[model samples]
Target: MPLRNPCALLPRRLQVVASLTLAVLLFILLLGSHPTSTSSTDYIHRVPYGPAIQSSAHQLVENLPQIPHDLPHVNTPAWLNPFRGPAHTPPPEQANSSSGEARWYTDFKWRNPFSSDTTLDEERAVLPPLAERARVYTYFESTSKDDKTKKIELELLQVWRRAWWAQGFKPIVLGKPEAMNNPLYRAVQGLELEDAMEKEMMRWLAWGNMGTGILSNWLAVPMAAKDDTLLEFLRRGEFPSLTWYKGLESGMFVGSRGEIEKAVKEAIAFPAINTTKSMFEAVGKETFAVEADHGAIAFYSSATITAKYPLLATKLSSPSTAVQGLALLPQLINSHLHTTWQNTFSSGIAVLKPLPAHTTTLIQPALDIARNLSQCPSTPIPASCPPNKPRCKPCVSNNMLISVPPVLRNTSSLFTIATVPHPYTLTSLLHSRLDLGVKFVRRETDRDSWTVAATKELLGTGLSSFSRLPALKDFVAGSYGEARTLWLVAEEPVRGDSELDLDALDWHFGFQLPRSPVSDGKSVTPVPGPERRPPPPKEEFGEGPPLSEQELMTERSMFMQAQMILRDSATGSAKGKTRGGSKSFAQTREVVEAWNLADTEVWRFVRAWDARRQLERRGWEEEEEGFLGKGTFGRWIDKIT
Candidate 1:
């Protein structure tokens, strides 16, 4: 009995192992006896990659590391040697010139900027010239009729002029008590109050040929003077500071003359949308339903563009005024002939939503003409297209409108009007540099639940087609920027604290918001800093509070240094001096310098959004429906059939 079963005498572990081995052998035999049509070998052959190999069966495989783990350690063959041998050997290049074309899987390109270095050249090319002369255009909207209030506003403007003078820029004071009466001010009355004000100020600045300017409502003091050096950085095109703001200040804007002109041209090209039926009837038939609230009406105007055969109704606040961004249809149409086609073509129409809809009446006719032009064919010179200018026509349907104005009829591309939810102030102030990023600051206070509710409703329902998405940051580099729009909606209501209010309006409206009492016309003291803090340290003779002098100076100095670094790196590249290790080192330095001065919160988000977009776009390319081998064929079939 003791010798009968060696397995029974074995240890517990050995006994269990023997039983498992027998079970496996029995199972394999059962599988082999009743083989299915698809065998394991056939299944293995159908695997996505090559057939699975029994690496463990090889003699030396047991000690060899795994495939990926040891892949880098594998010795290179002599044929694959990258180095050039002797002088007799032909020179070798790493990349084949013939195969330089982008590959579907291997090659990649970023549609949006992920790094400052990638866009440095583009940014440099678009930088605004630091003009020889700079002028200050200020606007102050007064709710109080008291003479004392007007006096204080004038004093504030004087303070700003003195500040600019200290920085060596001539300050032409164009501020008056009635400055806010400009038509742009009225257009944005019901929406984006501060942003509209800034745009109105920008138009006035541009018309005056004031190359350098600031738009402020005299609510807060100037943070810095017009910076030409910064303009140099801005002209390069990438993340240029076209519109700047301080954390705790009033609608502070400093931009180049070029920015003003560019914005004015865009504003003029596309008229503002007039919500009044009488005015809209003039542009085209008022097809869309009109909402009652200011915000809702604004939403409908902009959202209208997303429709099939979309027609936009845009009107300038006052077309008759020479300083008006959308003045005199005939003269404005002629002015477009001298500008680059991209100036008119790339940007269709951008409308400021104006009140007192009368001023915008003339723009309707122009918009109708543009809508007809959009319908004109993209190819083979339509008779209506001008011989000299051939660009993307603003087309609606295939049918041509013979009633179109003679000057506008022959134009290659008619401007597509973009009726924005907010006034085009931020759009105009930043001008083309607006593509970098946009941040909207909304002030929701417990005092006004109606406002909070209205804000949430507008933001949630998608004021513009872009804001419809929940992840605004995700859309920053793509849809929002692509659409040339930025709508910063508040997620929830906030307490009306000075700091919180200042931060919300920081990007577009930097002024310290008036408190409930002040807004209600009650007398309240204007404290420079936060409401509770001791007054900020004043400049000599207590002229005004100097809050950001050191910070501003430091910022300006850093930008100057970065400018020099960029110049040197560019020169090195041009001269072909830096190559190999030196070239790479220079490039690394260039990247660091490009973003060295970008410390503002807006830029921080811009960089983060861009990086995320790059990563997503890369991953998306492998599975995107539009690509050749991706899902294009399936999508095409789905569409055709």
Candidate 2:
């Protein structure tokens, strides 16, 4: 039927469409029958070289002697190894060893062909005893020529000595006079330098002449001084010269005595304009620098020096800055502060002043009353008195006196008694008793403590309304002694039909009660209960509101305040009193001074933390486009959520 002109049955347009379809089918069949040439050309274009070159290379490889199946494959390119040699045959003594071991021995011998047998034996031996090699020397020069600077330098040396001693290394701090006496220093002192800075920097070279062990800057605190592998390597006689940071050799380093002396002497002999530059360059290979900026100022200085002298660049063994920069600074500061605080505040007893709202004018009067009642003579009953005579309690009962604050009188009984063998012990005993009473009241009551309740109530009125409260204004403006008065009260069981007087206590403590039981004595005011709301509708799509600056600031403030309070409480100020009760007035004052000093440190840490956050925020802002697509808004959303 196709042969009988099938197009004749169709219209002109249909005939034209049929003809076009037949042509396309024929073209497809032709392409399918002979796709080899096209595919080959495409593959050749995709590959590295043309078909002719590939074939020639393949032929050449095939004609070459085949590598033994037992031979290990190397990562070298085929072109580089055009003439593949036979596998290396080890000596009969090493024939039993593995291929890798043989190769290592070969490489070692090739690298150190001129090494003596004794030197090789020493290098192969295990690390020597730590006592023979654990010496770390540092040079201490006061940046300023004042007595205060000298004192600070001495303190820094003491800190360094303690730190290194803890790490099993004998730390030596060399001063200017000691450096001047050293032959190495004398040798370099005569050399002309471009400026005073170069002359000052030349002192570091003396450290190299002092030892075969590690040389460290005064500010370079050790992080891994006890690392076994590192110590073992450093103890080796043939150990290579190692530098920290960007290989500037200014922070810390360790090497053989000869290598260090050689580097130092070479640096001194070299007539360079900048002696510091020459010294750093002549040192050794760069390893890793400390990541922290705490006591690692030496590493930073080295990095800066390297930046200024790009010619000293070398491949770093490790890219990481060793320690955590953000966390370590505050940790070091806190550690130092804690040590000082413990030394100053270790007394068994201390006197703590109450917060501003806790102090009251009533404390002195109560003290006077207690003193009088304690000293009152007891009444004695006459032996001849009749049995019907009414018996009365003594003025001073059981040799103890009790005092109660008016606010707590209806709700609870409060008393404070201190017993001591000697009159001199009375003051500490009284402080202990009052501290215990204050703690007991605070723990038993619900936000009824003067400071807590008053502050909450004042804050509830809003920041703008603070001026409306005259008591708060006076509390803020009053003297420290006037504002922080102690109220001696002890919790006791309430007797009789007395009920808790919440209203009276709240009024006394300056707390604004949220609700009253009765309004004007006519109608009862309903207490507001927790409101019940309907469940939120399920969100099909869309995001919540991004964290605002106000919310961020509020959260940061709360976090910092909580940290400060926790740190303060950890100092044992909130621990009431010790059982020994032997602290004198001077000891108490020392305790107070310690707390003040610690508080200052805590605030300083808070400021540093805030500053770090600001720096991180600035970094995020700078990288917003690449990191967060929507800039600041996106960054905030990303960070908060």
What digit string (tens of lDDT, one per residue) describes model 2 on residues 388-448? 1113222222123233222211111222211101111111122222222223323432221
Q: Candidate 2, which ten residues in sequence have the lowest lDDT sum?
A: 417-426
On lDDT, the leading prediction is: 2
- The lDDT per prediction is 0.30, 0.35
The number of the candidate with the highest TM-score is: 2
For model 2, which pairs clash?
359-485
Tens digits of per-residue lDDT, candidate 1, 1-641, equal 33567688899999999999999999999886745676778866665542334443454577776564224576445567668363232222222111111111111223322222322322211111122434445543434454543444344444443333323334443322233443444433443323444445333433335345554433223221122243233223332234533221223445565654454334333344232222122232222222222110001112221231121122323334312222222222211221222233443432222221111222222233233222222211122222123342423233322221111111223322222111121111212111111122112111112112222333443353223222322333332232233222111111233454333322212122233222222222223334532222111122233326564454334434433443454455522223232233234433332332221112233333323323333333344234222332211110111
Which residue window of length 10 is worst by lDDT in model 1?
Answer: 293-302
Query: How much does each candidate deviate from the true structure in C-alpha RMSD?
Result: 29.3, 35.6
lDDT of 1 at 597: 25
- In angstroms, how far off is 221's CA in candidate 1? 15
